[model samples]
Each structure stands twice: as C-alpha cells, then as structure tokens.
Target: MRQNDAVAANAGPRVIVFIVFDGVTLLDVAGAGEVFAEANRFGADYRIKIASVDGRDVTTSIGIPLGVTDIAASIESADTVLVAGSDNLPTRAIDPALVEAVKAVAGRTRRLGSICTGSFILAQAGLLSGRRATTHWRNVRAFARAFPDITVEPDSIFVRDGDVFTSAGISSGIDLALALVEQDHGTDLVRDVARWLVVYLRRAGGQSQFSSLIEADPPPQSALRAVTEAIAANPGADHSVRSLAARASLSTRQLTRLFRSELGTTPAGYVEMVRIDIARSALDAGRTVTDTAHLAGFGSTETLRRAFVEHLGVSPKAYRDRFRTAIGT
Candidate 1:
C-alpha cells in the first residue's frame, strides 16, 4: 500500500506525496512523513508516498537507497505535494528534469509546498514567484538572492503564502507537517500527533529572534521605514498605535492596513518586537532583568518576563544566562 498505515474507515485518504531526488536530505522526508503517519493513529487519514524524478530508486543523503512508489510524472493528483530539501540543492543548479517533474505535479495538487531548501525546486519551476516563502536559515540568503522575484522570509520556521507553504531548514518540516495536519483535522488531533512525536505544537518564532512576532522584512517604502526606524532608534518611545499613525502621516486604521500589507505585522506588534530585541541586547550585555526591562521600554520586570516567555519561549534571566556576553558572574 502507498500509505504507511491503513486508511481505516475513511472514504478517501489525503494523498501526501513527497518528491525526492538523489542526495535528498533524509530527515526532510522522514520528519514530516512521520508526523502525518502518526496523525493516522489519532483517526486522521494520510496516504504518504515517495516519488523521484524518474520511477527509479534514488540514493538519499545517507547513501541508502530510497525506493519510490511513483514517478513525479505519474501522480494524477494529491492533497498536498511537498518537495523535500537537500544540502546539495542550494549549492548547485537544480536539475531541469526535477524542475519539470515538480511543474507537472504542481498544478494537480491542492497545495504545493517545499521542505527546507526544497523550495529551490518550486522556485526553479517559477511556482513561487511573487509568493512569500522560507527555506533553511542557512540557505535563506542564497535562496533570496537567486530568486529575486520571490519574497524570502529569512526568519520564519514556515511560511504559507496562499496555498503554497515553505519551511525553514531540516526539522522545521515537522512544524509545517503538523500545521498541515492541524489544517486538515484541527488542533485536537494535531495535538495528539505532536505529543506522540515529542515536539511542540508550535514554536515561538523564526530562526533569528526566537520571537514569535518579528517582522518578515523591513518595509520597502521610505515612509514605512521612517516609522520602523524611529521605533528601533528609541525603543522607549511612546509608540502607541495613534502615535505611530501620526508619525507616518496616516490614520491608525491606514497604518495597520499598511503594516499588514507591506510588512506582515501590526504596528504595535512591530514596536513590541523591537523592544524585545532591545531587551535581549541589554540582557546579553549583562544588565539585570529589571534594568533590561526599562532599557527595552517594557516598564516592568514582570512584563518583560511575560513578553519573553510568550514571544521567545524563555525568561529574561534565562535568556541572559544562556547567551550572556561575559563568561562568568
């Protein structure tokens, strides 16, 4: 059977096809595939299949043969088709044959996605142009530079731009897979799947910040940059929604709409994240959490702790101790 587990009572299973090529990163396939397979035990239905550019078996990154059940050209349709990442992908020209296969199956899938650096294949096929996407943090710079038309979210663990989804390097595919399961089945089933997998249902933020609400990019327009730059310059400034709107010569609603459309964040959210960054810097410099709180515009130690835990999944003191500049107390 194509599925790792029986379909059980379902009328039809969600067909999830993983497209692979030689030297494909092994975890990029197994990490996500395991999530979907485990979801099945919790009453979800996912039919997982492995495919290669050709029907022939291909060698994986670990020098083991991964037998393919289908060729990319043969898939009639799929609930989701994810292109798996590889260490080799970002460094070399994507094989034209692989790109062709992705192009052929992409239109037939309900959602087309990529795991880690597999985004290169989709981008190579011109499927990700004008779409917000992510790849392994290590390759994000190259991915962005090579595919200038695509908006590369450098820090995101995963990005879903419309029906297309892209995830950060390696293990983040598990995060994206859980999200897909959540979308299909809901939080209840996905929670069980995550518990079994021994992974968080959601990580706080992306690669750089460990902050859940960081902005994807600096705004492209000078007007928006003016507002953002002001906040960064003085994290302690009174950056309420009304204040930022006035600074930008816009109304609060207009400011919000612009932030959402242009930067993928709210004005207030941006300000808070900037303050968090400032706080992190202060803590890294060996400032006490209380001192860091005011330095970062948080106003109180309790507030700073709450913000840190909520956004970065850690406390100020904990973050400081773990990443302090000095070696000793």
Candidate 2:
C-alpha cells in the first residue's frame, strides 16, 4: 500500500489501534489515544481503539488491567497501528505470535509506530532493518547491539524514517502523538490538544531531548548547572558560546565540545530552540504573535512570524488558533 504525503492536513475518520502486551506501559497506549481523541475537539474525524495479540484483557506494568477486545485482524482494517512498549524489565520479550501478527499487519496498515521499548518489537519483526529508528535512551545500547543494521540514534527523542515512527520514553510518546496530530489535523489543532493536556507545547521530532545539552561529565565544582539555569531563565537574552563559557568558567572551545558531545546541537542552536519553546508557551497561553514575539525575545513580530513559518511550517496566529481554547472557561 502507498503511504500518503507525510504533511497532509487532517483527513476524514481513521482508525488507530494500539497493540498492548502483557506488562505494557499504559501511558504509551494512552498517549496516542489522547491525541486522536482531542483531534475530535477540533471536529477532525478520527477514532482510537485498543487491540491485543489475542483479544484478551491485558495487564499493565503497574497492575492495571485493560479489557481489549480487538485482535490482530483489526490491524488489517486500521489506518494506523501503534505498538506500545512493555515495562523495561529484562524479562520482557515480544511473543513469536505477536511478531508474526505485526508483520502481517505491517503489510496492510498505512503507517506503523512504536513507543519506548516497543521499538524492540518492531526490530524483532524485521521491520526496522536498515531503517533509522529510536527507542528509549536507556534501551538504545541494547537495541543497537541487537539490531546492527538499524541506524539507532541514541540521543533523539524520536525518529521518523519512512512510514515507521518511534518515540522515546513516557512523555516523549505524548510528543510523538502531538506530531501525528499536527500531521493529520494541522499545527493549530495539535497545539490546542497540547494545551488541553496541560503540557509544554509540542516539540518537533527534530528537537533534541531537554537534557541533551547538559555536560555529561563536569568537575565537581564547575558552575555548568548554574550557567544552564541562567540560560533557561533568560532564553530571550543573547546567550553566546563565549558568554556561557565565561559563566561556566570553561574555555569557549571546551563548552562547544561539551554541547556537541551531549546535546547533538551547537550551543547557539540549543538557545534558539529555547527561545522558540518560550514563544510557543506564550502562544499556548493565548498571547497573540505580536505579544509572544516581544515576550519571547524576538526583536520584531515579523522576525518571529518568519521563524515560526520556517521552523514549524505554520503561522503564529494559526498555531494559537489551533491550540488555544477558543472559549475561555
């Protein structure tokens, strides 16, 4: 089957199925569910459902039970199928039957996704071979060790290569869901969904993990943490590599090296992302683009608008209209 254009706006009603396993991470399944459910809030057509390998009641890692009635056959009819991760215990393994089921469904579904340790399941089914994908960071080494052909970027919060998308741990699943929402419904709708969820506005899949920029190894007395706090506190400020290096008592070259090694981004790019994040927060809180631009440290509304379009592929007003609550309760 052919995959539709990746950036197409919301289409009509589609079925999303999450395959749950024993000792599954409940949040992985719920995170995807919430996004599609919230899409309905914008009058976008979609539905969320749960399925299991055997159409039985499945238990979560935390002991909660989910009564999933659909079976693998449901995957053939699904527009999208999500595979959720099991608890991060070493004992977990993808069932042979589930592997076959996923492979079978993979033949029919429009798209496939994995969350956290669920990437392990996709790898097991041979679906991730030669594809760029990611799992939870804690599992990255093991995943890479097991699947040598898959280009596992250990530092990413998620990876979208071809029709298969994989997200990192718990909260990152929410990020992945918001991205899917944006792809289907538009940026504005996803933003509103994020606001309704009381979370930080969505970060693009390309955005690095929040902790990625911190120094992995620092001298005990180094002021790196304080410097990072200051950067976050004043994201709108002109935070140059030299300035941060001075604040941390390290050479500019040393600071840049640290940022590259830990964050997969230069210090400047990280700061720009911080500013964008602040602007998104302001927009989510109902600020207009003009106000958000000023509050988030952009020198002008036009600059902010251009940046939003370039980085997010949407306008500031559209982002706010899609995400912020229209009726103030």
lDDT of each: 0.86, 0.75
How many clashing residue pairs appear in each of the predictions shown?
1, 4
Q: How well does each candidate superpose onto the true structure, as a TM-score? A: 0.66, 0.61
Q: Which predicted model would earn the best TM-score?
A: 1
lDDT of each residue in 249-299, candidate 2, tens digit only: 889988888767655577776776666778877888998888888887787
Error of 1 at 252 (Å): 33
Q: What TM-score does prediction 1 earn?
A: 0.66
Question: On residues 1-329, what C-alpha lDDT tens digit does candidate 1 reach at each position?
Answer: 12222322234888999999899988999999999999999998899989988788889999998888999899987888999999999888889999999999887777889998999999999999999998987777678889999998887889998889999989999999999999888999999999999999997555655433443656476567789888888888899999988998998998899888777688888888888888988887899998999888999999999988777767788788867866556
